[model samples]
Target: MSAQAVDGLSRRGLLKFSVGATAFLATAGVTASLSGCSSSDTAPGFDALRTSDLPFLLAVIPVMLDGALTGIPSQSATERTLHGLDSGLSHLSPEMLKLTRQLFDVLGMAITRGPLTGIWSPWENAEPGQIRHFLGRWENSSLELLRQGHSSLLQLVLMAWYSQPQSWAGCGYPGPPKI
Candidate 1:
């Protein structure tokens, strides 16, 4: 075929495309630069605002944890709450949609495949320290990968977090306990 066809998506073409994509984003804007978010208001250099905003916390938590699960279905509130959110969030950006697919698959496996025999999620052993460690590590990696701007996949993830409204109450997170 004289290498004229296949639109260069052949192995050689893919390599070329990858290199071009990386260089383009590297030379792109600084909006792509990001930093990890600390877990609580009490954390050093953390934001003290929004302690009352339960929904915001929930919306942010899973993303802070795994760089995904920003759109998981809820079981925390009444059926009506679930129904309302189900309709409103019926469509997510392609990136969030992809993460939703991944999380749902994990949920399905955890349910059907049964625990211990199913995939082992580090979260299963979560204590405050362990959760903090995992969340910090994931967010650090997410932001670092984002700042590098050489990988399309992590940039897509950053978009998913930024594009969504950071409100968990809308997703059925009731207000947090009074301290």
Candidate 2:
């Protein structure tokens, strides 16, 4: 309990050890949960994403691409965005796909999800305001992982939404040059 030493460890060393141990345990727990289910247990879907992940993306697309998605019916826009995201994900390298899958798994978990995303509700129940706040936090977070997650999601959503012909007019592209 003294600041000088505890057992054989200096107080500073002991504090460091405790922090490291806690982080290791937390990471192990998350990895175990993510790997607990076999591939066959997952609902069938795109090459990169499980069926459960689609709902999360559905919730995110409109919030991230609000301008492009405006005036488009929610259901149809969500469906098209999902398709575009899947197509884009399919072309990623295996390493990138693996990383993306891990990100989705973390977001899917109730434990890590709340702390990381600040959205305690399931994707379906999450309000657009809550999702937007979470996105903003991640985008502006000092942590590298949070920033990377925000970047990845934003890039994927923007690419998927803007690639559509319907979105072309929003940016004034006027359809693939006269070729």
Candidate 3:
């Protein structure tokens, strides 16, 4: 929900296009499934998600804790990256989690139609290596928490995947070919 993302959304007709697209897709899906007319062709990615996708994503949050033992490390250069991602994802507000669930459902449906876009790649314009360094450590912290099991980390991880950009785009965006 950064201003930049909002800004990107507002440019030209993309904002309206995005919303309209989701409605079209969602309705088309319900229609096809109801008609029993091979909804499979209409919705492709959803079958793979299942409910487990939520739990798996949730698990990663706690795992991050185990990865970086020092909470807010003072000496390491990675401190900022770790802290930022941790802070970004760790706080799963109830409202956000609800939205994330809807997002997950939407992405799952989108995947059925095609590969997701604008979701996985971080939007910070950082080098792929840098984003990975940050997200990877965040994942590690989640992993540590996962080692403990049955923690809020699991729920948060689920929320993370649910809140993924790819998931949101699935509700609307037409993506590049998977090759």
Candidate 4:
């Protein structure tokens, strides 16, 4: 467990591995987009999220929103939350939008998703527990990139859900002061 070697990997070897992984991720992202695996077409009725992103988004929304959808029908609530997310994303700067889409591509592409999130099944077929486990794992991951991805997903979902008027009462947030 010395600084020079941990788990039998030398510092230089670790550095090389990190660089290689970064290159792989960059290449995979470009390939995913150019190869059409990350569809450019928008999801049905969505302004920002792509068709390839819908399955992952649909699966994650309910799990992340959890108890917040109480009184509303799940389908209706999910659609509204998704629309909120879409609207929010539509306003992002081009760079931010590209990064967000890349995050979705990572989740949508099977090659990246399985290794990163450990969910090999198509997102449409993924169970809530499986999604929860992935989220928890990413949130607690030692990798800073995974942690940032977790934060981005959490922020998007939470902001989308809480922005809806119907959700305000659930969180005890009174509407903005009359001023």
**Evaluated with lDDT, which candidate comes out highest?**
4
Q: Which regions of candidate 3 fall more than 4 Å away from where they truly are?
A: 1-12, 21-50, 54-99, 109-115, 118-179
Candidate 3 C-alpha lDDT tens digits along 1-179: 99988788676466576566657645544554455432222122232223323332332333343343333332231323233333443355756543433433333343432322223432323344443344444345323321222234345444443344333343453555579
- Quote the lDDT for 84 in model 1: 31
- Candidate 4 residues 1-179, lDDT tens each? 67556745765676676677667666778888888888777877888888888899999999998888768877877888899999999999988988888889878889988988999999999999999999999899756677898999999988988899888887788988997
Better of 2 and 3 by TM-score: 2
Residue 106 in candidate 1 has what lDDT?
26
Best by TM-score: 4
In model 1, the Cα lDDT at residue 93 comes to 64
Query: Each candidate's lDDT (Cα)?
Result: 0.35, 0.72, 0.38, 0.86
Ranking by TM-score: 4, 2, 3, 1
**TM-score computed on alpha carbons, candidate 1:** 0.26
TM of each candidate vs. truth: 0.26, 0.77, 0.26, 0.88
- Which residue pairs overlap in candidate 2's backbone? none
Across 46-65, the per-residue lDDT of candidate 1 in tens digits comes to 22222222232333234333
* Candidates ranked by lDDT: 4, 2, 3, 1
- The alpha-carbon deviation from the true structure for residue 137 of candidate 1, after best TM-score superposition, in angstroms, is 0.4
